[model samples]
Target chain A: MHIAVEEEKCVGAGQCVLAAMEIFDQRDEDGVVVLLDAEPPEEQHAAARDAAAVCPAAAIAVRE
Target chain B: MSAPSRVVVVGASAAGLSVAETLRRRGFDGQVTLIGEEDHPPYDRPPLSKQILSGEWPEERVWLRDEATLAGLNLDLRLGVAALSVDPADRVVVLADGSRVTYDELVIATGVRARRLPGTDGLAGVHTLRTLSDARALRETLAAWPRLVVVGAGFLGTEAAAVARAMGAEVTLVSDLEAPLSDVLGAELGELLVRVHAEHGVKIISGVVVREVLASGGRAAGVRLADGRVVEADAVLVSIGSLPNVDWLAGSGIDTGDGVHCDEYCQAGPGVWAAGDVASWIHPAAGGRMRVEHRTNAGEQGMAVARNILSAGHPAPFAPVPYVWSDQYDRKIQIYGSPRGCDRFAVTDGSLAERRLVALYGRDDLVRATVGINMVRSVRAARALVATPTPWDSIEQGVTA
Candidate 1:
């Protein structure tokens, strides 16, 4: 699975980091989302998807 | 006793949609029915006060999902229909069109409706911003640059005031507090917002109660303050608060006092659950029952409900460090935890005069919450301060260091 993020759309709620800290982080300067991993192993797919699903701004997109 | 063969969810907004999506993600595949009162598909509400109001993005951008993605869920989608009542004992929900749907499990996420002043119904040029249609009407009225009076200086009212003023409307903000959002963000930060609004040419009338909305020619003329001072306007937006949509569950035997009363797990009754703004559940962390109206809480609670529904006999409590945010002009105000009733508030980082800082709220020697204005990273990091209610002394020492 591959993950993509839109910095402009990110509200910096940090919900993505809460769902999957290993796959996502936020910049310190601004809270725009930081994609730590664009591709993840099978075990991390569910967490990645959950991060996308719970994003309030719909800033994260996961392509499986 | 067994896994639910069919799950029925009421209200198709963020919380309801989250439950349905989570169920499918968990491979439930059961007959999932999602019902909504609005004809539009599930969309985000946070943008309605800003982007949608300012015409920065079209209505389509607010949709939570596109056509093809929603179709993939294969839901029993019922749009533009309202749920009249629920018969919990019979496990059936009666619809407005006289149709009934039976379910093994039920989730209610009806959310809330915008509160209006008494006797303002059907009045021309009087509006409330809650649904997409409400935003559309308010936007159309704002385009004409009418003299707009916004009652109640809460987040919704404050944001709408900023938008209308930016749209070149003669905007006047009237509220009972000393400053806008002082009741939630405290007077210091609230005063900072007052300066922000004033610098943008927005007139603010605070510390006065609106006695009545004046009408001339059968339209909203303006509002009369309790002090007998009158402010005339061509349009008025009332943003006082909201009432949870629990009236439909009148005879359903579910508690609807303030909202759908639920346990720590968001369960209302046997095989029944509630989420989003319509849910007033016991929060283990908050040490009491609470109902959050923020966008993030809606989706988070929905996921928790779906997980508990699938787990059946073994349900986990929904404990979260509640978060909420607001955007007005150049300021992005974000809050973590509950800041209401905090005995003490201190600027731990930055300065209030600069309007960019991190503040902490303490109650009974424990950090209760944190607020940030244009200081996103600091506020996000401060979540740990109140995630489990840390001691104020520890936070103070850390700040001093």
Candidate 2:
């Protein structure tokens, strides 16, 4: 699965980082989300999808 | 509680909706009935003071689930239906509409009511922001840039100040405490937050309490401080805090005081569970009963309660490393783990001079909580330390002041 993040939409809620740290991170300056793994393995898809779901800003986008 | 043929959830907010949705996600396809006092569907509340108040995101953007998705769940959503009480013996929920629905399982997520200052109600221009209508009404007046006096100076007060300031309105925050959030977050961080708001042009009057609302022309003209000082303002936003909405459970025999008392699994009794801002459950970390009013806690606890009910208490206790986040303008405050009972604090990154860093709080040699000021990675990493805390010296091994 592939991951996409809209940093501009991030409100720095930090739910994505907590849900899927392996694939998502946040900038220290503004707390905008940073995608660590653009293309996560199949095993990591669940966490990546969870990151998208829990994002308060709905900033993360996961595509199969 | 075992997997049942029917489950009824009251309060359609975050926790109640989470339980109902999680039940379906966990393959509980039985008849599910979700009742809500509010006519609108479930919506997110965190943005009410942030994006919604600031008018950055529209009202629909804050909706937790779309109408299509909600309909797809196929759950009996009784919107605008107020639950009068619950009968534990009969396992039935009585409604204000004079209808009773029998359930094999019940989940209470009544949530909380915003605490209003005495004598402030019935006064024009005085408001407490707890619902969408409150946010929308307050936002409507933001365009005029009226002088806004925010009482309490906690998360909601500070957030209201930021939102008002963002709209180019004059904002004054009257807080009884020396620093905002000092009661929850430590003094040092609270002071830093106070500075953050002060720097953003929010006139924070600390160590001062509002005695009464002075009125003019039958409208709130200003607030009278304890020191006989009157702070002139057109509108006053009263945001002291919130109280658990548990009055409906009165005489129901389920156990409730400040909130519905429950076990670590959020079980109040057999076939009954409670979660979110209304559940005062035993906290494994704090070693005492606590009610967390944060959105994330509501969601997590709701999921945990759903799992435990389905698993028949086989699931692990809902021992969450408490996490809460606040957004005031450009700066964001994120905290994880229980900061209570902490005595020592150390900044692991950045410094107070810059007012941007990750500070770790500890007590009895074990790290208790971490507060980050625009330091996301450090805060994220600090979650690991919550599970396995570091001693004072170990935590400070290479930390710079």
Candidate 3:
């Protein structure tokens, strides 16, 4: 599975990091989301999806 | 008891959509049905008051998931229909179109409706922001750059005022509180927000009650303040607050007090659950019954409800450090927890003079919430303090102020 993020759409809520720190991180300068892993392992798919679903801004999209 | 084979979710907004998505993701192959009152598919609402209202993003951009994506979920999608009532004992829901659907488990995610000012019904040029249609109508009206009067100092009203002012409209913000958001963020922060709006050319009038909506020729002309002064306007937005969309559950035998009253597990009754703004549940960590209207809470609570429904009789409690944010002009205000009724508030990082800081709210000698104004990283770290509610003295001791 591959995940993509839109920094311009990111609201800096830091929800992605909270849901899956291994796959997502937020920049310290501003809380815009940073995709740590565009392609995560099999076991991390669920967490990656959760991060996408919980994003209030709909900034994260996961393609499986 | 075994997991239910059929799950029906009402309300197709953020929370309801989240439940459906999570269920499918967690391998729930049960027959899932999602109902919505609006014709459009599920969409994000936070942008309604900011991006959509400002015309920065088109209407289609606010959709939570594209049609192809939502269709991939294999849901029995019902749009442009309302649930009239439910019979918990019979496990049946009656729709407005004279149809019935029986479910083994029911999730009610019907959110809140914007409260309208009395006697303002059908008045042209008067509006309320809630649904996509509402935002679209308001945006079209704002294009004319009318003299807009926003009644209410809450987040929605303030955000709309900022957007209108930025659009070159003559904007007047009227609030009952001493300052904007003072009721939730306290007077100091509220005054700061007021100053920001004032600097941006928004005429703010506070500590006043709106007596009525003034009209002429069957259209909204302005608003008459309780103090007998009238503020003329080409458009007016009544945004005092919202009421839970729980009227349909009138005789459902489930508690519909402030909202659908539920336990810490989001269960309203046997085989019944509630989420989103319409859910008033007992929060274990806060040790109280609270209803959050924030966008993030809706998705989080919906996911929790979905998992709990499939937990096989051992449903875990839904306790989250609620998060809320509002965008007004250049300000990106964020809150990690509930700051209402907090007795002690201190700025731990940055300074209010610069309008960028991380402030902490303490209640009962424990850190209850954190507020951030353009200082996102510090506020993100402060969540730990609110999650466990560290003692006030310990947090203060670490403060370099």
Q: Evaluated with lDDT, which candidate comes out highest? A: 3
Better of 1 and 2 by DockQ: 1
lDDT preference between candidates 1 and 2, better one: 1
- The per-prediction CA RMSD against the true structure, in angstroms, equals 1.5, 2.0, 1.3
Which stretches of candidate 1 lie above 4 Å from their native place? A28-30, B398-401
Chain B, candidate 3: TM-score: 0.99
Estimated TM-score for each candidate: 0.97, 0.94, 0.98
Clashing pairs in 1: none
Using DockQ as the yardstick, the better of models 2 and 3 is 3
DockQ of 3: 0.67
> Deviation in angstroms for B287 in model 1?
1.4
Q: After superposition, how far is residue B135 of candidate 2 from its true place, in Å?
A: 0.3
lDDT of 1 by residue, B48-83 (tens): 999999999888889998899899999999999999
Between 2 and 3, whose TM-score is larger? 3
Q: Pick the candidate with the highest DockQ.
A: 3
Tens-digit lDDT track of model 2 for B141-244: 77789998999988888888988998999999999987678877888888888887888898888898899998999998989999999999999999999999
Q: What fraction of the reference interface contacts is present in each model, in order?
A: 0.59, 0.44, 0.59
Residue B290 in model 1: lDDT? 97
lDDT of 1: 0.91
